[model samples]
Target: MAVFRSRFARVLAVIGLAAAMLVGVFVGTASACSCLPGGEGAKYARATHVFTGVVVGRALLSGDPDTAHDDKYRYLVLNYRNHKGSAPALVGVETAVGGATCGIELALWSSYVVFAQGDASDGVVETTLCSGTRLASGGPPVTEEPPTTTTPRPTALGGSSPACPPIA
Candidate 1:
């Protein structure tokens, strides 16, 4: 009877372990951001703004110090194609802090080929990881030259020589 009980305990332990692993897999999938099947051409076709630019500044809108879904990032436009209208010298793009919600965190001073969807006239553009935005290193060759000199932009930040547009 003791031997039978010990074997039963081991079997139960193995079953519990398997169940925990299965639950973990499901939980991981639940937290992951899923995207529809599409390539660059499809992403570009759906984008309202496509540009190569450097992230000059960023601001936390709300939520914890980590970030909210709509943190604003300012970019100095280098080469771009604005489907809505003429492209501006600088633009604001909003996304979450990271990829949990399919949002992308653009590093300050880093260049990216941003495939975004928003009206440039409003002074703010928005994008996500699903938008197909990627590092400039792997993007198309820049045909036009970037700005030779930088201009000071306004921001809500204090004591800054260069800044982004004030938070609205």
Candidate 2:
């Protein structure tokens, strides 16, 4: 009787541990999904103007391989040049595509799109705004040459000279 009782207690402890682990896994997954804009049903709302920046990193693709069809999705890290004069800032977003295959078709670094805009605070641009299908399968678009300007001599000896001063 004593041995049987000990075995029962051990089983109960194992069950409790398993339940705790399951709960932890669920919570972690829920938090990650929630971090995405629009919760689970987020979709593109309207078109908006957005400045383009260079792709500073490679795209990441993920999805289940055991499905009937091997489905995959893409995510990109963009370095957006906030204002006309500021340095580029790094931003990451999940590439929105109808199916896994479409996501794979989109180009990485060299490609630019008018993606559906999202809240600026989150730094995520929804896939909806990605307009102007992929460009040629090569480098990024040609950017206009920055206007040239002549520098003025320093007014005082000890003062710092302005670099890339505004064009008159």
Candidate 3:
């Protein structure tokens, strides 16, 4: 009876240790994509291109044709400013294929307010879930006010820069 109790105690201890290790592993893993807290205004300041448009089309592009995993999703934007802009009418926006990389999945034919950043190395305009892009249905009502420049403000770390552009 004493031996049985000892074995049972060991088993319970092992199970508890395993559960603790699993929880630790999961908690550490989930810290991969950490975003700082900010509002849409802050997101607008970080973005290079801001537009409201619908996803007219989507396609997967592969760096190597022989590879099975296509790299990213290329979305075609249209139906805005009478389908005209200083940028192309049909702009191709690239995003990672999964949310694990802070990627966004824009539904075809659905409109969204996109806050995109220009990739300096590749020169491609891209957006992510962290960029404050949202469905147009839930976005702020469109106003005709032009963007007004505000006094530059210091960042949390104590550097000054221009304020966010007003949402159109």
Candidate 4:
């Protein structure tokens, strides 16, 4: 009877260990890089900088594969296909390499459709594979989006001083 109890205790310990390992495996995969899963249009809407450019430079700042952005790659682009916000013709992108940190290995001198997030306060351009930034297979687009658009003010029925636009 004592031997039976001892055997049962060992079995329970083994089961618990197995369960813990299974949970760890599931959690690791789940917590790993998960991009904004959506189509091109959805990614475009979220991106602050969307343009095609040639990568002119790449410098590895850190050897760590787990780093968010350890490499600084510069791009030279003239055309802005879709620029939601203002950016220089030449932009510096900080990114990582390998899928471990959700970074894509961007080749030097290769053209890419750079979808980035520009920090206005600090003035930095950040790009990642998760941002849908990919290589431009052919080249930059032939035409660009229209430079500007003006929002016309709604006129009041009888107004000397212009009132703010109505909420409705």
lDDT of 4 by residue, 49-162 (tens): 777777776665555677434444443344335446665666677775556566667777777887778773443477777887777894542233344435555566653434
Model 3 pairs in collision: none
Give per-residue CA lDDT, model 2, range 1-168, as digits (tens): 999999999999999999999989876422111223331112212323233454545454545655433333334545443322222255554453344322324445654433334454555554432232233343333233344456554645655565555447
Compute the lDDT of residue 70 as modeled in candidate 1: 40
Clash totals for all candidate models = 1, 4, 0, 0
Model 1: how far residue 30 lies from native, Å: 5.0
Q: Write model 1 residue lDDT over 1-168, tens digit each, in one string.
A: 999999999999999999999998877533457876667767776777777777777776665555335444444444454433344767877776568777787778788888888777877778887888888889663333344445666444644555445557
TM-score winner between 1 and 4, please give it.
Answer: 1
Relative to the true structure, candidate 2 reaches a TM of 0.33
Supply the global lDDT for candidate 2: 0.43
Worst 10 residues of 2 by lDDT: 31-40
Per-candidate Cα lDDT values, in order, are: 0.69, 0.43, 0.71, 0.66
* lDDT leader: 3
Every model's Cα RMSD, please?
18.8, 16.6, 9.7, 9.9
Q: Which stretches of candidate 4 lie over 4 Å from their true place?
A: 1-31, 63-82, 120-123, 138-168
- Report the poorest 10 consecutive residues by lDDT, candidate 3: 79-88
lDDT sort, best first: 3, 1, 4, 2
Q: Compute each candidate's TM-score over C-alphas.
A: 0.56, 0.33, 0.56, 0.53
The CA root-mean-square deviation of candidate 4, after full C-alpha superposition on the true structure, stands at 9.9
